[model samples]
Target: MVAFAVEHRPEFSALRARLDEARRRATVAQRSLIPAPTLYFGARGERAVIDPREVRPNAAGQVESLGSDHRSILLAADVSLALPVFDRAQAARARADVDALTVQENLSIEARRVRAEVGAARASVAATRSSYERWRAIGGAVEEATVLARRGYESGQVGIIDSVIILERIARGRIAQNRSRAEYWRARTALGRAVGVIQ
Candidate 1:
């Protein structure tokens, strides 16, 4: 019954969503041990015109082709990686992963327990309700029988002792009816608690 409630209950989806979020977060945390790579890229271009006497020369005694009247462009790209040198980060990540797993497992266990409780509560409610119904059905019959016994005693057809017994039976029937009603409500309260609707 609790299993059914977990699946069909309106509030269950939100609760399950929280668990899913926790699972995703734990998975991401577990992968944090591996360092990510870096990428870089850049480009530059320019069109330039220089005076006839603005040329530059190099130690080779020739114009170093410094683009005296040139269109020039430069492009560069690189990727960098950092090696895992220290064990501390790996150890911490591993510990965090273990903790996250533990949290999830504990939640699973508690959920199973709640499901079981829900099943038990449902059964209890049904049993108590059946008892209550039986008591209610017999209550009217007991009252009618008590009335007949009283009339019979007044007419000398039944003894005073029989009337007293009949009254006692009526009282017991009322008590039983009340007890069954209380039990039914108590079972419903238990069910509500198991479903987390009540504190």
Candidate 2:
């Protein structure tokens, strides 16, 4: 039944999702207190280099051309990081974020309510099942008696009063059986509701 509630109920699933989202937000807020690190990577490729030539003053103050040592492609990478100095407000907000919401407690209460409902439903089912079994068995037996009583009356072997009594017993048994069957279905419906199924 616990598995049934967890597996079949969309309300419980939505609650779990909401809790997960809250935890994620709390974690994000917590991580905001520290510096954020980043990684940078890049690559460049070219068939030919147009700006390969470069001029610079040599040891004797003469301009030198560096095109002979140039490559067609260039690659670059760098890492950057930043830390917020004033995080008092964010830290306070992170601390203010609560783990337990009123709705979460209400969900717990709902679980207990479901448990009680399921228990009551199970008891009703048990009671109705026995009632159904008893009524159906008695109904079958009374129906046979009713048929025998009618045949006996027709053959002048039984009185009209006896025949009427048997017929009445059969009628009462049928009514009880019908009621028991209906109650059994009603109990099953209650159990389904407790377990979070539509039907």
Best by TM-score: 2
| TM-score of model number 2 | 0.62
Instruction: Score candidate 1 by TM-score against the native.
Output: 0.57
Candidate 1, residues 83-150: lDDT per residue as tens digits? 45633455555665666576667657767877788989989999999999998888889879878888
Q: Relative to the unseen true structure, what is the C-alpha lDDT of residue 199 in candidate 1, on a scale of 0 to 100?
A: 56
* lDDT of model 2, residue 155: 100
Q: Which pairs of residues have clashing backbones in candidate 1?
A: none
For candidate 2, lDDT tens digit of each residue in 109-173? 76777777778888888988898888777776777877887899999988889878877877877
Q: How accurate is candidate 2 locally (lDDT)?
A: 0.71
lDDT of each model, Cα atoms only? 0.73, 0.71
